[model samples]
Target: MNIQELLVTGTRLLKEKEIPTPRLDSEVLLANRLSKDRVYFLSHGDERVLPEVERSFLQDIQRRSRLEPVAYITGKKEFMGLELEVDPHVLIPRPDTEILVEAAMDMLKEKTGFVHVLDIGTGSGAIAISLTRYLPQVKVTAVDIDPHALKTAKKNADKMGVADRIQFVWSDCFQNVEGIFDAIVSNPPYIDREEMKGLDANVVEFEPVKALYGGEDGLDFYREIARQAPGHLKKGGSSSLRSGVPRPRRSEGSWKKSVLDP
Candidate 1:
């Protein structure tokens, strides 16, 4: 089938399967299968897809229909303008998390010389890598509870050319972390236990559970991070946390609770 026909059929099939973002998913998957960018779809929609290429594209769509994240199928997610490699072992970084990254950037604007950040529960190292990308003099020590997740983060750091600036630590929150930091950033799991059942299948079924659930109240990671961060942070150091909370309410309430105690 030709490019236009293939995208049309794929979009229809995904829509029928109740996949959200069907058209976008179809376009991305088809473009990836053809070893082209999404622009290729718009520019060459009428070009014929090879029989073998079509088969591969269809298989990717089937995985998406089964509720697997498109990022998992594509094996890459663009975060903070950097493409990060992701797998089932680590949580895919989201756009909401970018808020915390920007907050940290703003906090560090006036600081200089040997700045450090401690990224607790650093999954794919998106925050740490992005920070190093923007701040040439900053050092980031990224900690993760899961060794596999640390491996994934290191891979991403290398891919983004920030491997030298990031120190990957295997720790449960702050357990093994060392030194004080100018800032601490985290996007820890904050989904409540009961709320897990209500998440869309793309997340509940495919994303890592350890990276999604945060105990019955959804405050476990926040509590733990706040409890331990004080010892690892420099005096007056800041904490930038990203979660499900709305930005304003979080800055006024939950975030204050999580950081003050530390």
Candidate 2:
């Protein structure tokens, strides 16, 4: 079938499954399968898709209908203008996290001299790599408990040409992280047990659980970060926690502010 016909068929299949954004999803999947931009379809509607390509596109449509994320299907997610690799091993980067990154950039820019930052659970290196990419004065130590996630983050850092500036550590929270920093940032797993149960299949089934669950109150990682941040942050330094919860209970020591994602 032609591009237009194939997209219509794909969209119908997704719509039958009650998937939101069916048309956009169909277009994205087809564009990825063809290694062409979606805009290509607008002008080349009559162009026929190869039989092999059509079959693969149909498979992707089936997966999306099953609630698989487009990012996981395409193996890439664009965050902060950077197209980063993603898989089931790491949490997919979302648009909301860009606010946290911007907050970090502002905080780092205010500090004088070379600044060191710490990124807890730097899945896909979205936060850490973004900071290094935009803020030249900062170097980041990004740690994660999952080595697989770390590997993925490392590859992203290398791809973004920020590998030299980011030190990927295999540490759960701050257990293995050393030294203090001018700032600390994290988009930790903050979905509570109950919340996890209600999540859409796109997340609950496809995304990594360790990257989503946050104990009973959805504040376990916040507690851990608060408890450990004082030891790892410089005097008057800041830490931003991007989670569903508001600010965490303050741990004693020097803290400027906590930027929480509402």
Candidate 3:
């Protein structure tokens, strides 16, 4: 079958299955099977796909039809122009969290001496590694409660050639963590248990539940971080909370919360 025919069929199948971005997903799957870029597929739509290529494309379509994320099928995701290896072990890096990184960068701008950063629940090591890549001289330490997540994050750090610059720790929150940091940043799980039922099937069924559900009220991790952060933050440092309302705790009284300027 030619690329055009395959794309049309794939799109129809995906649409029938109620998948979002059907055409784009079909194009990406086909291009991957052909070892070509989406632009190449567009330019060479008339080119015939080999029998083996057609089979592979069909397999990918079947996976997508079952609501598997395209990134999981492709084994890679683009974040901040960096190609990151992804798997079921870690949550996929997202664009919205780039705002957290931007906020961290802005906070780092006014400081002169060496900066230390702690990334809690460091799935995929995206935050820590990106900070290390951009800042270069900053010291980064990332902790993940899940060992599998830590492994995946370490692989990404090594692939990106920044493994030596960031430290990976296995711990539940700050249980095993030590040392003061210039900044602590995290995009921890904040989805409430009650809200899980409303999430997409792909997310609720396929993505790691431990990485998504943040307990009954979704403020468990945030509250813990806020309570423990001051002990690890340098005197003039800051902790950047991405989203969600942190449950108030008595231990967080020493730290002042400042709203970042937009």
| The best candidate in terms of TM-score | 1
TM-score of 1: 0.94
lDDT tens digits, residue span 1-262, model 3: 8999999999999999999899999999987777788999757889988999899888999999999999999888888778888888888888878888988988987789778899998998889888888887777899998898899899999999899989999989899899989999998887887788889888877788888888887767776776787779888888876664343332133123311211
State each model's C-alpha RMSD to the native.
2.0, 3.7, 4.0
For model 2, name the residue pairs that clash.
none
lDDT by residue for model 2 over 49-154, one digit each (tens)? 9999999999999999899999999999999999999999999998889999998898789999889999999989999999999998889999999999999999
Winner of 1 and 2 under TM-score: 1
Which pairs of residues clash in candidate 3, taking residues 3 or more apart in a chain or in different chains?
none
- State residue 228's C-alpha deviation in candidate 2, in Å: 1.2
- Where does candidate 3 have its weakest 10-residue lDDT segment? 253-262
How good is model 2 by TM-score?
A: 0.93
What is residue 94's positional error in candidate 3, in angstroms?
A: 1.7
> How should the candidates be ordered by lDDT, best one leading?
2, 1, 3
lDDT of 1: 0.87
Between candidates 1 and 2, the lDDT winner: 2
